[model samples]
Target chain A: MGEWSNARATSEAAGIGAAGQVQVDDDLALVARVQAGEMAAFDVLTRKYRERIFSIIYNITSNREDAADLTQDAFVRAFTSLSRFKGQSSFFTWLYRIAVNTALSHLKKSRMRRFFSFETINEEMAPGEIVDTLSQKSAGDHSAQLAELQEKLNEALQKLSPKHRTVVVLFEIEGLGHQEIAEIMHTSEGTVRSRLHYAKQQLQADLQSYLS
Target chain B: MKKRRESRHEVSGGVTLEQLLRVKRAERPGPEFWADFDRGLQQKLFKTVVDRRRSGVRNFFRIVLHSRSTYAMPILAAIMVAFGIALNRGSGDGPLPQAVTAPVDMVVSVEANTRASSPGAERFVVDLLNSGGESGNFRKVMSLGSINTPDAGSTRYVADQLGSVTGRGGVLSMGDSF
Candidate 1:
């Protein structure tokens, strides 16, 4: 297990380094073009980051429609405020901050109407082999058990407060670093780490049955 | 390595939180939905621009409404003065005749002087002498006179009526009688 983990970690690090560099370069160029009044360049930026932004918003809000609206709102705000962007941070980080703030504001306003529904995972995007391996190691139909786990995970995620949930979504799901999450949340990295710790504890307690 | 170890140690149960969260990474809208997302964002951008323009206009009016009375009154007065000046200038550019510049008192005195100087004055004096100072004959002779001798109170009323009759060139001819 340790060997497998190390190998996976090395591979992921290599992939991330290459992909991260390319994405940063592309984002910088697109942002410059947008600053120069090339609106089509913004469209490229949107396409590149829309899925990630939407996913983060979706996880936080737990409502696809609200996520879609907030995602669009975030992009629109980003476009309008592009001039103020000094490029101190990567474009994605700035965009993430916008998305996070928008989602947080929406959550605050619509606290009464907070309803969460889990979406079914697409087969192509799902880690079928991992689920199969885990399921084989246990005693259950792999797909059915995996679906139940997915449902429980979503419920557990929704049970978290917006702040903690945001940290978890950014750190665990989006695979962002603690520093990046801190920057997005506009909090200290220590606060982010603490939130992540508390959130994982709560989620672990909630999903104890499935995990076992 | 330390960060990775810390992350790994943070997981409470046997299952990693990262793996569990990864399962949900697939929970997204379909490709067709994403294709439509850009179009929707574009529409939202367009709507934002339009709303900003509308709000800008609304805010301008709002500021005008909420401004201090001291500032607002002066601005309003300036606007009214400007409007008056514009109207005055516009009237000057047209070929229309000027309004009656003569005051009613001045007009009456001028008419009296003209009547006294004309040949009609001699006839008026002869008629008055032949009437033996009778009030009815004096009124009849006064009515026969070619000049309108409106009383001080009726002067404005007569002038207004005459001004309308004469149209733009409001000249009171001496031969007019009332």
Candidate 2:
């Protein structure tokens, strides 16, 4: 059994280099090739990032149509501004910043559409029932509930300000570590921890119903 | 009914409502999710780019008009200068005008007189040199004697000097002249 385990470990260790650790690797050779005007490299990057990028937009917007639109916009903007991407950070992190700012800009423009939007949502619905409750809620209610929740989240997010939301998003949803999140957000580990702590407390209080 | 379900799940710290909601959201389905998402994205991108292009064209025209408004004085001045030159030639003002040459020098000095009441103010001998160098290459040396702060009189003085130099087809030196 020990020998078998040793063999498995050797195989896993062998998987640590270049093509083997493709997912964990942050080297954006594909992006670099795209920067050199390689359309095919860009296509590879697009395919790799599309689903994950779409997932982030979907989480924030919660509307498939809008999220998809924003995702495509994010990719196109990334493509156009690819020359400006200095690669001080990984390409993915830079792309994530673009995705977030694009989504936030969209929300800002649609702010008037968000007024009193949360009034009719059932704040008492359990986690499992929340989406279903939303789906069953009036077509108008679906939009209203989503808008309200977003407004609340935005408010809660704003309370911690820019620094905290970035850390929370990078760490919690994106599953990045303190070190990784620190690198992406460009702060020390201590700052990341403080922001994360404050962010969680704010989220817990504001999103208390969502958590319950 | 939803409230009651929500209340049941609101127990202290075990697993927050938000986490459960997240799990539930993960399970929520919109059939043909990926396909629909792709189609929607393409349409939105097309619309946004189209809108930006349209606005960009409008802004180009607006910018051109604004620039013309801003440059009306300089343009008018050039036209007037041309007209004046034509009139002067018609009236015969002593064989047109002579080539103007204005020599300038920047003087800088440090003196150790040590007689000034304020310790900060040290009297020092200075020699200055000012001449036309490429603007990009021009560097500010020691700044003393006459400092052109952004007072209105100073600004107008500089503007008049510049206008006179350009009017007489003379080059303007930025710093001290030797």
Candidate No. with top TM-score: 1
What is the per-residue lDDT of model 1 for residues B99-175, given as tens digits with 9 covering 90 to 100? 12323443344345557754576765654455344323333333333234312212323444346456846433212
Candidate 2 overall lDDT versus native: 0.51
Tell me what TM-score chain B of candidate 2 gets against the true chain B: 0.27
Model 1 clash pairs? Answer: none
Query: Quick one: best DockQ, which candidate?
Result: 1
RMSDs, each prediction?
Answer: 26.3, 20.0
Tens digits of lDDT, candidate 2, B1-178: 6853443343323445344323312322244655564444434433444555567668865665567587766676786798796667545633222211121233212222223322343222211111323221112222222233212223333444457556856443222100
Highest lDDT scorer? 1
Q: Candidate 1 recovers what fraction of true contacts?
A: 0.43
TM-score of 1: 0.61
